[model samples]
Target: MGADGTPTVMVVDDHPIWRDAVARDLAEDGFNVVATADGVASARRRAAVVHPDVVLMDMRLPDGDGAQATAEVLAVSPSSKILVLSASDERDDVLEAVKAGATGYLVKSASKQELDDAVRATAEGRAVFTPGLAGLVLGEYRRIAKGPDATSAPSLTERETEILRYVAKGLTAKQIAARLSLSHRTVENHVQATFRKLQVANRVELARYAIEHGLDE
Candidate 1:
């Protein structure tokens, strides 16, 4: 963590100017800018040492692909959350990164404030997406769930189901709690239970499942 008890972060991008600017902005916002790397190898090497709370990764690196780097970094430090910062908004790229265990995806066109907030959200285990990509991902999940070989769906309580819908809509636990007239801790508990029932790791996967089953409607 940083001096102010803020989370630690690493910026990994092939472009020097962009990397430096992001690092500077995050550092100014009270994050501990632990390390900066320009490619996959360096990112993996440095990440093992620092184990930052959040890693801002570019999808295209000079030495290797960013999704592969995200997997490698997580292999070395499973607690670290990776947020893909890429120029591409292609559906395949986003899905590939998500499959590789990225906590979020953001495009290069995102504003500085958006990027900064995404890092913070990633560290807190929330799923972030660039604008319209969340719906694309949800649509893919829906298609898969509707396939002939789809298995029987997991059972969720009515409360859990409602919360899942809120999650699919990208509402945070606190926000959901506020809207539902429940305590934040109660909402978090429901979320964790929902995750276990669905066997998903984070909000993104849970949201995908909910959307796939038409619970988000």
Candidate 2:
């Protein structure tokens, strides 16, 4: 948490000027500006340390895509919320970020007030998207929801199910490992394998899987 009890945030855009501007605005809004990263590697490294409550990232970084970095960050800080803040509002970009476990998506054109509010909403676990993008994401999810039932879904090991319950409860991988008496790497491995088996792109979908299967109970 931040000094004012607001959530801590990380800005992960390659452009220093835009990144700094966002960071400054967030800081001014009483959010704890934890750290800023220019690329995927640095984002992962800083995120591991700060374990920020929310991450604001651009879709295209100098080294990689924001969606990929979102997955990597969640792999390390499972409880962190990622919010894609990019210039592009294309449907593909929005869906990709959501599939990558982003809690929200906002374009760079958003006003500082809008960005601040979105950050707060994301920290509280709300799925935020730039005006029209939210409808598209929801429609995609609804389409996917009709494709499979949890019962007929691919099978998972007992351990995967156990870890997934904690995931659904919003526990970080580190926290889940501590509770289950498992190594960090072991838990992460299970999560990755589960991702492959379920064909879910990221943690958000993983949570949905748990809910659909009643594992979240």
Candidate 3:
């Protein structure tokens, strides 16, 4: 969230028209368009100053790919959540962006409403992905989990495990709170604790851990 409570966003894309158009759309949708950047360098530089609540990132930039831009921006503004708005839904690209610390992934073909919802969810610390891409990401994580590192998984409290199951099933913090008869903040706290314990950066990774451990059911 921004200083004024509106979610602040930064648009990073190489094309001026697309960049400006996204910025305009977000502004019209009630988000504070704090800054716009054309590539990795500008994104990093501007993020350090604005520290936006969300960043709408384009995969192809003049200087580098969105994965690099995502990593750089988060390095400067760790609290900023990145939502990749790209044309390609290729498996490697999605996985790379997620590995680079992006909080969500949305194809450029998504409806404006979907983009709006995704940005809002990203700001609120939810992992958003274009429908099928999420399964692909989860599959990758599942395969990786079969490796030797899977044996050292961390343990969680019963309440934390219950919340993790909800997270893996794509329930938002608010929804989980309602289902568990707990406060929203309490749900978020448990989610954060799960994140810390699992050594995962975001909900996507946490969900992966849950699925790998058969907790998604």
Candidate 4:
């Protein structure tokens, strides 16, 4: 636990072997780890008990989708981070997970070192995605926004949108400030403004939101 909380991690995947393996990996990294090979409800119950710093789950489970589990976890523990884990990097899975509040996404192909870094980043409220996963998430958001039931995006100011474009290009706040001839504090404030308006936590979410709404243009 850093100042925020203990790095307790909950694993929710149906495969017993995989679940145990992930739990072992996290434990080896000194994380307080809990794992369940059950459904979403069981995972939620375990999460409530452990109140983990992060939850790593498979997108598909026996009883329900990990998206619902993510919502439940965030509802119960708003500060907790969620990371989707599975073999599916499908656009729909990626978007659904992000929209449901997951801060990270990883496929089974990830090495132990990569998985460790991803979880650590997520626990710090950062977003992580494998190669090409970011674009997949953005595409799904585009599809959602184009659907009939789509809601209007939060209104953004010119500065906020400009800041968002830089974010979409993967520039850090300091880097963005340098490029835009603004103070670092000013750039950070703009980033925070975007976060609040989009109701997301980190740069990856902000970038995905920006790209989805055509703010990059």
- Candidate with the greatest lDDT versus the true structure: 3
Q: What's the CA RMSD for each of the models?
A: 5.2, 11.1, 5.3, 5.9
Model 1: per-residue Cα lDDT over 54-172, one tens digit each: 99988888888886898889889899988888765454555566667776678888887888888887778766654234444444444545655345434457787676567667777
User: Lowest lDDT 10-mer window, candidate 2?
Assistant: 207-216
lDDT of each: 0.71, 0.71, 0.74, 0.66
At residue 105, what lDDT does model 1 achieve?
Answer: 77
Residue pairs that clash (backbone atoms under 3 angstroms), model 3: none
What is the TM-score of candidate 3? 0.70
lDDT of 3 by residue, 23-105 (tens): 99989999999999999999999999999999999888889898889989999999999988877635466556776777667
Looking at model 2, the pairs that clash are none
**Candidate 3 local Cα displacement, residue 142, angstroms:** 2.4
- Candidate 4 RMSD computed on C-alpha atoms after optimal superposition onto the true structure: 5.9
What TM-score goes with each of the models? 0.71, 0.65, 0.70, 0.68
- Candidate 4: residue pairs that collide: none
Model 2 C-alpha lDDT per residue in residues 1-217, reported as the tens digit of each score: 7767889999998889988988998888788999999999999999999999999988888888887899899999999989888765454655566677776677888888889888887787664543234343333433444565444445567787676667655576678889999986677667555544433534334332211233333
Per-candidate count of clashing residue pairs (backbone under 3 Å): 0, 0, 0, 0
* CA error at residue 152 for candidate 2, angstroms: 7.5
Q: List the residue pairs that clash in candidate 1.
A: none
lDDT of 4 by residue, 35-113 (tens): 5546688887777766778889788888888877888877777778888886653545555566677765788788999
Q: Estimate the overall C-alpha local distance difference test score of candidate 1.
A: 0.71
